[model samples]
Target chain A: MDNQRNERKNLRRQRRIELGTQKRSPLGWTILWLIMVVFTIWTMFPIFWAVITSFKHTGDAFNPTFIPWVQFKPTLQGWHFVFITAGERTLRSLKNSILIASCSSALVLLLGAFAGYSLGRFVFRGWKNKDIAVWILSNRMFPPVAVVIPYFLFMRTLRLLDNPLAIIMAHTVLNLPLGVWLMMDFFRDLPRDLEDAAFIDGCSHLGAFFRIALPLAAPGLVAVYVLSFIFSWNEFIFVLVLGFHKATTIPILIAGALTSKGLEFWKVASISLIGIIPVVILTTFVSKFLVRGLTFGALKE
Target chain B: MKYAYRKHVIKWFFLLPCLAYLIVMAIFPLTWSLRLSFTKWLATIMENPEWTGITNFRDILFKDPRFWSALWFTVRFVFLTVVIQLGIGLGLAHLLHNNFRGRNFFRVLFLIPMACPPIAVAFLWKMMLHPDIGIINTALQTIGLAKVKWTTSVVVAPFTIVMVDVWEWTPFMFLVLFAAFQALPVEIYDAAAVDGASNFQVFRKITFPLVAPIIVTIVLIRIIDAFKLFELIFGITSAGPANATEALSFYVYLTGIKWMNLGKGSAMSWIFLLIVLGISLILLSRLRKKI
Candidate 1:
């Protein structure tokens, strides 16, 4: 009976000690949480503001205070401005951006996959292949501006300025290199035995690549596709200079709106929201794939 | 014999489209620009009759003050933005390294700026820094500080550009560095703690040394990126209250598009490219070794 009572007393003492430790340390946790909360608010507020401001009337934009509740008098005037008021210019820009981004990404993927497969599977003629890959990367090192003058002159001479094709072609120039580089890395990680097996089964080289390698590289393809698409979508310099009025993209439009002098905050905010919506949707859906894609071969053994 | 020839032709065909695109879009333009840099021509009305070989390059290098100033400005902006961005990024990554509630949410939130188009962020920040109605000024006034013209003056305009850049990009650094930090083995940290080292000491001695390579890599990348900074500054200040923010890239825009001085612009652009290429080559060689 004495031992049981002493054991119970010790248990109570230990429980109290654990509770004390837990209680005492929450101060540090609270401070850390507070800092994080503040940062979260700071990071998210501008984006939130842009979204909210998009649904607001132009007059309501200049108001000094932020209202927590959505105004019942909320208007789609800003959205109207973006879609309707800007004439067919906005629609044209959107269509052009879509065309350029999609086509460029598709081309990049097809070519990149082929190039990546070759680099991965075949031991080419010499160190020449590696040098070729390096040279391709070096092309990206040249600033877009360096080539802009000549591109402008070339496009103008060819009557291709203000055309979506110009931007598409330019975007491909940059995107292809990136795609090849990334896809090569992806292809490098793939197992060789699978290809060997396909070859042993009497499949031709292309057939084996298609059957064994291509399917396995789907995630890498998706990653490169998404990256190329986003890059082409967000690309400003080539689009801005080459496709001024005819091939205006959302970036160029936003730039034009912002720099147009008057404090058209509502319009700017609305256009910005439109510009970001697709990317936000994309991020939420494929964020997992993005993590894997972006960190390709980084943590691999 | 015909079958072998056909196979060789097919192989070349496979490589043809990409090679053609590169030649037309990249190689052709590069060479054209190099040649045009030596000839005086107006892009708007293309009647170039004279070759001024090396004059354009000479003028840009020796005679032009704007070119030198623009180069210096670009270098300065790149240096400042890269350093501050990396510092804040590393600090934030460190702060968020330990596990906590809502860690995933915080990570997602921090990545928002990077995912958003830079053009939009530039406009949003421009609005937020408006002289009279901006929240920044309002906050300053509320705190009993005098409201100064943020973007209206020469001195403050460049500073504002840098600040906006830091705000938009520090998160990028945070994301990259956070991944690097998370990749570090926890046992190393545990060993350091068991040796009675303080958190700061462990971070300084062990954590930093391990992550230094990544930090250097990020800094070099950011420096290269900063040299190409265009849209944000173009949207915000248009290279200035008084050319205070006229970076090398912006100068390329102003010269080529705005003034239509194709020869001078092409020459200036080539020079900028050469500088960036030089830096990138050094970094790329280092990166190849590290990777």
Candidate 2:
């Protein structure tokens, strides 16, 4: 009799579990669908507007109609204006931006990796190293404007104005402190056993670092590169102030377009679209690294 | 002894690149600006600067109306943007925190505005806010509301600038705060619910306090960033029909870069620098304590 009762209880419990699961699955799915719909609209609206406007003839863009309902023939004239007629200037700007952003990111990573490893591995005699790290991070606290004039004049004296190398130099100064702080955290999180084992097996410290540790920290290094690159690429103020006709960047081009009297709106929109393409593409593929980099040192293992 | 000396040399070698960049790019320029602030010089024609200690400061503080107005505008902009951005950001973060389909896509979408150039976003909004043929006016007119001049009216211009800033930057606050929210443990939330707390009560008693530090950090960062607001306002209105949106940063540009008054511009730059540094120090101490 007890066994039969137990079997009945088990059957009821199974039915309850089945019903709970059935109820939750549909509810979860509904919630998910709602979220996706709202989020897609919110995020895609402005970008859609920008791209569509870029395609529209000048008059239609000013009269602003919602996408798929606007009455106008789409034309590639804006793209032609931005890329072909202004192609030489735009291409020069793009080249300069690419060079500055790439070189600065590379330099920051190399320096940051070396210093990060040192901080992660060594302990010095004084409390000075900790203080130094703090000081380096604190440099980010200084407003960019405070140092702009000085940098301007210094560059002027050195005849580095309108030079891509000058912008790269300026960016490295701004990004290096943050890079070191972040890389230090990444390096510290890595286990010392690999290095220690390598050291024991007749490997030099440098060899252990290159052969064992550096490979292990590849993801973190990539994170640093993506972030530093993005920051440099998107940097506007220094570029605007420092770059002239010789080394104008995409941001400078966009700013100039907006400021010019009676400038073609469609052309400005087209350039804006083009300016964001690289950033959007980079962020889409490497968002994981970007997010990780932003949250660096925030989460302690 | 030899090995110890060699290790020291290697350590310094690793530090050389960064130190070199810092000294040339950061230290030298900063010192030059500080020294230039106390001297009077014209960039256009004069090579030698005449010593004018405290004169530039006196002129700016006592004589320049634009300087004071710009200072007031910056303070107001920073305060309003920080509060509104943080409030909206927190709300959106909370709303989106639960397990939902398309959360990942939503997260990416929310970050889109931040990733795009600020100047581009500003220009887009300017197109939308245009009075005669703009969509915003058209929608209002369709709904039987009178058309409002957004950029031309001085009173409306600063407000429009604020709105543009909010539209472009609220997403940034949302992204950062969402990350903070995700870092929160679920067990504590469950415990709150078990104690007969409503969802709102659970959020108030548990989630809000847990996220306060991050919220403060975000606010502080926004304060510093807002003070640097230039591109958007510059693009949309160029400090407006009546200098309504003439922020301190823009003012510095006008005085120094446009007007060629290096002495006054240097003074203004120094003042802004000091203010930024002071606020930054406060934030640094707060962050340090939290960590």
Candidate 3:
């Protein structure tokens, strides 16, 4: 008992030193914090400049002012131009982005869940599960430009160009493979006993899946939801080509801020923030699940 | 629990939609593009696609100087961006994995760059890199340095793309690796230390080999996505300063869409697809073996 206690004490002490919480000089910490501070500034200064520039008057936008009241005055000119005065088209695009992203992600989850559950839980002849999963992932990996050109022509042929449906269909195709691959892992990780017990209780396979496995995998679903939504939301190429006029999204709106007079810094910054804020909220919501979800569980042990 | 083979009916019901949908959307389009690759037809001008077997492929491989230059540019861009991101990101992850004062605040700040879409990120950098009125140049000049022509200069234009990409993506690499590090068993490190292993030795022998799989996976993902670099070029440079930053994706877009050379664009994109597929396969197979 005495030897065991001493060994335990040594182990705890070793952990402390390894974590740099013990036996570290102030000089070392100062350098670490110094690196952190520099990294933070590199990460933030552009955004800090943008935040100030967004609120600055168009005339003051060129002045390189970091402070609002002292160095320069803040105005709503940028916000007003992007929202109030020329706001009609901008609002329409924001609505379009939200709708297209959500709708397509929902479609992806709907089809992907069933497919994922089937692939995970059941066996099919002539189609290996591993090969099927890899095929879906390979589709996801194909360059979007390859799809966009052909998709542009196809949408035009179908008279669906510039319709939100065209963009929605495109997003569903891009994200569904990812959804299936992610959801398959989640469903496969769930215990078979609960599902089997439900089946023994006269629950049909579909019933057991709907009542048991899905609730258990609800947390993972939220992860895939946010992942797909963000991909669909931030997408520009498909929207640039297929959703050209009626279905344009915020990224394109920000891009459109470039005019013959050059980009109005205030205008571009405001529009970009509009595009960024939703993703920030969504990512934070599912951040804990992200390591698994974002990497398709490639890092999962 | 011997469930009936009858459930195979339901199983196919669940799986067939995804397969059918992908076939129509992915397989069908790819097949069509493959067919288009052999023809000589500008969709905008030519009424019918004229069959010209192997001509488009031959011309693109041999005669197109811009194609070779664009390929060179893309390779360099992917190499520089991935290497730099991996280096800084791994270092940051190792440092930030430890708990410290105000760590949470810095963590939250780091997450912000990844939140912005690629186009908006390019714009944010463009505003900062503006030669005269931009904050970066203003700071430089105030400290007694010459300003850069960020958009117009050939050398600086491509560098700016790499810079913006590094800033935007390093957080992703850092976050993923940080989580991987956090998930590691700390006891092993303590044991290594007790055995008289130096810090560098511990990292080399234990930490790296353990996380080697994760590194390979993220690097493979980054490389594949980096080859698809499009939004930054479109938003910031439009391959300006005389095509200095024209990526393969941009070149494909220019040839296929903007210039309306459908046949050639199709061929170039097929080549692009094959190259990406080949790299991803090699990396992916290595990853499988590692894990």
Candidate 4:
């Protein structure tokens, strides 16, 4: 034991001597700081511009000034347009977006939890787990455009076009695959010993899953829920093709403003700012989960 | 026997709804689309589609110049966006890889663009790219440069689409690669340093090789996702400036829904699917080896 400790200490010294502290020079640090500042400006500039655009009055909206408060007087006209005159449409779409995103996320989590439990916990003779997992993920590979045609025809046939129900079902189809993959990763990371302990305590498999695994995977559930909600809220193609008047979303409205004559910059910017509020809030809350969710747990930070 | 039956029932009961949903939503629609591609369907509620056997594909392949142009446009768009996004994303990742004050704050700020909805981002760019009042043109003019048309000119519209995509998704690449950089074993760097390797040499030999697979994966994923480019064009250009910026997905949208040419649309979509799937299979196979 003494010899082992001495050898470990020697190895540490050797490592330190070889690596030479790995410190950056002041000049290097200054250059890095400059790069970072430039990047920060690049990332924030467009969003800032949108905010500035949203605040401008109709005349000032077309003003070619980059500075917001200095070059032009800011006004509440765009906000008023978003909230009051076009208020009903905005409120209706916002309601539809919220209802659809939440309900579909609930459905996805409920259904996906079951599927994930099965895949993560059990191994069958004929069903190779990896292949099954890959197959489930492959469902997400088909571009929404590829499938929108049939969905359109089917919705038309069912007379469910422009209905929020249709949008919810479509959103569920889009997010359920993602939900399964995410929950599968969560469950796989959890040790089976806990479930075994529950089984010994007279909990059946389903009870063990619900009582033991589900409670423990609450963070995973939040990650899944937030992601699915954001995805459903941000969906554009299905809403465009499927909805008409009754179920139009904020994204559709924003896109529509582009086609109308005389680019209503302030109104479009205001509506867009309103549109991204829910997503922005949710993403800020789950920013830590963003990378894991994006890569499907391929690279965990 | 009863216990075994119950076990089997519970297991499948959990799995069946998801399978059934995919079958109805994914498989059924795809098969229907394939069948629709082979017929001449004008999308009348009452009229039956006439079976027209491969003519749609033949036309799209040989006769349609727009189809080929759109396909080439999409390829160029994907290639340019992938290159630019990777470059900017890597630069940002490298900058943030070191310890710095407010690093976490900047990292979160970088992710904001991606977190915003794609439609909103596109519209935001539209607001910025307005030839008359857009901050971009305004900035250009302020700098004593000629203000260029961003999304309205035929020559520049495609590049504008690529720019919007790069703005929205470069963060995605940065986040992925940043995580990869964080996970890299510092001992390797230390050992290389001990060998008196120069900083550029260490980066070129040690860092680049370690990050290459991730770079590949990120690029492949970006290519696959870029093929589904629709919202940006739909929101920003609407496939306009004379169809200069029409991606394959936007073309699919135009042919099928806007034109109401269901048969031709279906054909275009199937061909699109085949190409996307072909690339995806290659990605998947390569991914299998790496992971």
lDDT of 3: 0.83
Task: List model 3 lDDT by residue over B92-124, tens digit each.
Answer: 877655444564455566777876688888888
Give the Cα error of residue B51 in candidate 2, in Å.
Answer: 1.0
lDDT of 3 by residue, A6-98 (tens): 876576566766655566688878888899789888888877877888998878888767788899888989999888888998999999999
* Full-model lDDT, candidate 1: 0.75
Clashing pairs in 4: none
> Among all windows of ten consecutive residues in candidate 2 chain A, which has the lowest summed lDDT?
A292-301
Best by DockQ: 3
> What's the TM-score of each model vs. the native?
0.89, 0.89, 0.94, 0.94
Best by TM-score: 3
Residues B190-246, model 1: lDDT tens digits: 566557776688779987999897777667667877888887787788887778888
Stretches of candidate 1 off by over 4 Å are A1-24, A68-73, A259-261, A288-301, B1-20
DockQ of each: 0.40, 0.38, 0.60, 0.57
| Shift of residue A129 alpha carbon in model 1, Å | 4.7
Q: lDDT per residue, candidate 4, B239-273, as tens digits?
A: 89989998999999989998888999999999999
Lowest summed lDDT over 10 consecutive residues: which window, candidate 4 chain B? B282-291
Candidate 4: tens digits of C-alpha lDDT, residues A204-236: 768887899999889989988998898888899
lDDT, model 2: 0.75
Q: What is the DockQ of candidate 2?
A: 0.38
Which runs of model 4 end up more than 4 angstroms from their true locations? A1-23, A64-71, B1-8, B44-46, B286-291
Q: Report how far off residue B75 is in candidate 1 (Å).
A: 1.2
